[model samples]
Structure formats: structure tokens, C-alpha cells
Target: MKKIKIYLDYKCFPIWIYNDKGELIGNDLPKELADDKQADEVFVKIQNIYDNLFINDLIEFKYIGFSSEIDREGYLKMIDDAVKLLKIKLGDLYVIEEKIEV
Candidate 1:
């Protein structure tokens, strides 16, 4: 049987805008910002920072799998070695297995 293993990381960022009464506002914020010029300017600056720091920059990894006729123990040892060498935590590791119908 042939199998494949996959690993990935999921990330999320939340943006929040609030009104005077602490009411949450949606994405159409420019209209709301019209009421406060100073706030609007600050908001634009913060938004630019967010775009440059978070939106434009994201972490990613590329891994290539090689096929070998090793036993299950050997496969597991290889995975363990990779995780240790890469300094990856158990919580951040993900694995997907696929069977090749050949």
C-alpha cells in the first residue's frame, strides 16, 4: 500500500471596529469614519500597518515526500526525525494519509 502524509498550519486574524456605544461596525467603515477626521486618519494608518505586517506576510512551509519500500516502523522513525530536526511542536503538526490504488 502507498500512503501520503501532509502537514499544515492554520492562522487567523480578527479586525474589530466599534462605535461610541461599543457597537461593532462592519467593513464599510469609511462612511462611519467621515464623522471623525482624526479617527479616520488614525484608522487609515493602522490599516496600512495591518496590511503590511499581517496581510502581506504569512508563514509557509514546503515539504516533499519520497517513496520508499520501508516498513511502518521505518516510516514512523523518519517522521519523528523530521519533526525533531525541524523543531516542530506536536500541536502544530498535521498528517494526512492517502492510499494509492495502483
Candidate 2:
């Protein structure tokens, strides 16, 4: 199987679009490597999985507001859930590895 490594440093933000002074294009990689339209479609689903991670921000706010603290377990669970979902989506297509920065 191939490999898909996700870094935790991007704040779980999904940046699939590339915009510059004037030019706008879809960021490449998973899409570029996707050789067929079907593959691109699958990647779109995968992109959504990553995109949803952005919600963690709001969740974090809720946690802090309710408890005045950061719930480490919940925080880590969010990441773990994302990883599991990624693996399910990827199936055998690629190996999923998450990189966390300390």
C-alpha cells in the first residue's frame, strides 16, 4: 500500500485551494497523484474528512468555556477519530500516519 501522512501542525485545517495575486487553482498532491476521475472523486471524500477537522476549533472553545480548561483527552480523541476515519477511507490505497509536533 502507498502512504498518506498527515501532520497535526496544520491545526487540522484542510487547505485544498491555492490562491495567489491573481491565479487560483486546486492544490495538488492527492489529487495530482490521482490518475483517474474516479480517484479524484474518492480524494474529494477524503478531503472532506480532513476539512471537518476545522470544527475542532469550535469544539475546543466549547470545552474551555464550559470547564475553563483544555480537555486533553477530548483533544486527543478528536485526532484519534480523524485518524480512524482516514484509515477507513483510505482502506488499502495508502498507509495513514499522523505526525505530531512537540
Candidate 3:
């Protein structure tokens, strides 16, 4: 299986987007969020959007990007769901994007 790499922008923090192989994917910065709660709301909304898309089997994602606007839990759920769905479709032989530490 092939691996893909996703790089996050410096401005985004906390939430780290990733591809199936654990490569950083995209930045999810919800613009105009008034506060943390609002930010979380936006994340939930985004997740809902993604979830609906996934339910319809419309999205086949090799990578997903998220900005700092998404909290830790939110980011985790998104990544988990993304990978789970991808794996379900691609099977176990799929390769993930990541690096090995020496």
C-alpha cells in the first residue's frame, strides 16, 4: 500500500489533521468562532456534516485536515472515524502515511 503525507500550517494548533497513515492532512480553523464553546459547536457541526456524508457513502477520504479550532476530543473522533471508514472500504492491506523514528 502507498502512504500519503499531510503537513499542517503553523498558525493552527492543538488539533492535528491526519491521513489514513497518520499523516497530517488539513487545517480546520472555524472562522469567526466567538469562544471555546462556539468553537466546539462548530466542530460538532462539522463532524455532523462529515458523518452524514459518510453515511451516504459519499466520502472516500485518504486524508482529512483540521485546524486548532477543533478540540482534542473532536479531532480524535474525526480521525478515528475517518480511518475506520477508510479501513472498512480499503481492507487491511491499505498502507498509512507516517514516518518511523530512529
**C-alpha RMSD of each candidate structure in angstroms:** 19.4, 9.5, 16.0
Task: Select the stronger candidate by lDDT from 1 and 3.
Answer: 3
Give per-residue CA lDDT, model 3, range 41-92, as digits (tens): 5445544544432223366433343334455456556555544443454454
Expressed as tens digits, the lDDT of each residue in 1-102 for candidate 2 is: 345554532223321333333233433335434464544444454444444444355346221121322544554555666566555655665555666431
**TM-score for every candidate vs. truth?**
0.26, 0.41, 0.30
lDDT of 1 by residue, 43-75 (tens): 344333333332233564333232444543454
Clashing pairs in 1: none
Leading candidate by TM-score: 2
lDDT of 2 at 100: 40
- Any runs in candidate 2 off by more than 4 Å, and if so which? 10-70
Task: Give the lDDT ranking, best first.
Answer: 2, 3, 1
Worst 10-residue stretch by lDDT in candidate 1?
A: 1-10
In candidate 3, position 44 carries an lDDT of 53
Candidate 2 C-alpha error for residue 46, in Å = 14
Q: How many clashes does each candidate structure show, in the order listed?
A: 0, 0, 9
